[model samples]
Target: MDENNNLTEPNDSQRNFILAIYILFALSVVFTSVTSAVGAILAYRKRDDVRGTIYETHIAYLLRTFIIALIGIILGIILSAIGFGLIIIVLVEIWYLFRVVVGIVKFAKKQPVTPTGYFM
Candidate 1:
C-alpha cells in the first residue's frame, strides 16, 4: 500500500501477469535474451498499473534485474576476448535465475523486494 491506501496484494489479473513476467525472465535462460527482453518490455508496460502498490517494486526489481544481466552479458562478451568472458556470462545467468526465483517466492508471499538495489 502507499499513501493513498492502495491494495498491497495483487488482484487476480495482476497476479497472473506478474507471475508470467517472472516466468518469461526465467525462460530467458534457454532463450538467451529473447524471453527476458519480452519480459522487460512487458514489465515496463505494466509499471504504471501498479504505481502505489507493492507490485510496483516487483516491476522495478525485474527491470533492474534485466539491466544488470544485460550489462553482465556485454561485459562478458568484451572480456571473452581474453578467454574468461564465458565465466562472467555463466555467472550472470546463474545470478539471473537466482533473482527470478527469489522474486517469485517474494511475490507468492506478498513481500516487497528491493526495487533499486543490485543483488536483490
Candidate 2:
C-alpha cells in the first residue's frame, strides 16, 4: 500500500516458498523417489503465491528427473544390472546443482523468475 513496501523485495512468504523448493531440490537425490511426489503436492497446494509457483516449477523439474532416473535404473537393471543406470542419476544431480545456482542468483537479485515453464 505504501511506496516503501512497493520497493521492497519479495515478502516472507515468497522467500520461504523459494527456499523450501530449493531445499527439496537439493534433497531429492538423497531422499527416496517418493519425496519428489510429496514436494510436488505441496507446491500445487500452495499455488496461490509466488513462492508456491517457484516450488511448483521445482517440483516439476524434480519429477522429471526422478522419472528419468527411474527409467534408466530399470533399464540398467534389466540390461546389465552392473550399474549402467548410474549415468542418468549423475545427470540429474548435475541438473539439480544448476537449478540451485540459478535459483539463488534469481532470488538474491529479487528477480521474478519462474521455475516452472510457460504453463505456470
Candidate 3:
C-alpha cells in the first residue's frame, strides 16, 4: 500500500519483463537452451525486486519450470541408452511448451497465477 493506503501494483516495465521471460521460455523449448538459461538467470536476479508484487509469482513459476525442465532433460539423457530417453525428452519438451503457453495466456489476461504448478 502507498501513503494513500491504496495497493501498489507492479509497474509496466515489470509486467513487460514477465512477458519477455515467457517469450524466452517459449522460444527455448524449440530453438535453444540458451534463452531458457538466460530467462532463468533474469528471474533469479530479479526475484527480490518482485517481492510483494505480481511478478514475484511469475519469477517463482519461471524458476520452477526451469528446474523441472533441467531435471527432465537430464533424465531423458540418462535414459537415452535404452531409447526410452527419446520419449522422455520429447515428453518434457511438450510439457514445457504446454506450460509456457498456459503461463503466457494467463499472464496476458492479467490473471493471478500460482507460483507452483505444471499447469496454470
Q: Name the runs in model 1 displaced over 4 angstroms.
A: 1-9
Q: Give the TM-score of candidate 1.
A: 0.89
Question: Which residue segments of model 2 deviate by more than 4 Å?
Answer: 1-9, 30-36, 51-83, 114-120
Better of 1 and 2 by TM-score: 1
Q: Estimate the TM-score for candidate 3.
A: 0.89
TM-score of each: 0.89, 0.54, 0.89
Error of 2 at 110 (Å): 1.2
Backbone clash count for every predicted candidate, in the order shown = 0, 0, 0
Higher-lDDT candidate among 2 and 3? 3
Error of 3 at 82 (Å): 1.2
Ten contiguous residues with the weakest lDDT in model 2: 1-10
Return the candidate ranking by lDDT, descending. 1, 3, 2
Choose 1 or 2, whichever is better by lDDT. Answer: 1
The true-versus-predicted C-alpha distance at residue 17 of model 2, in Å, is 2.4
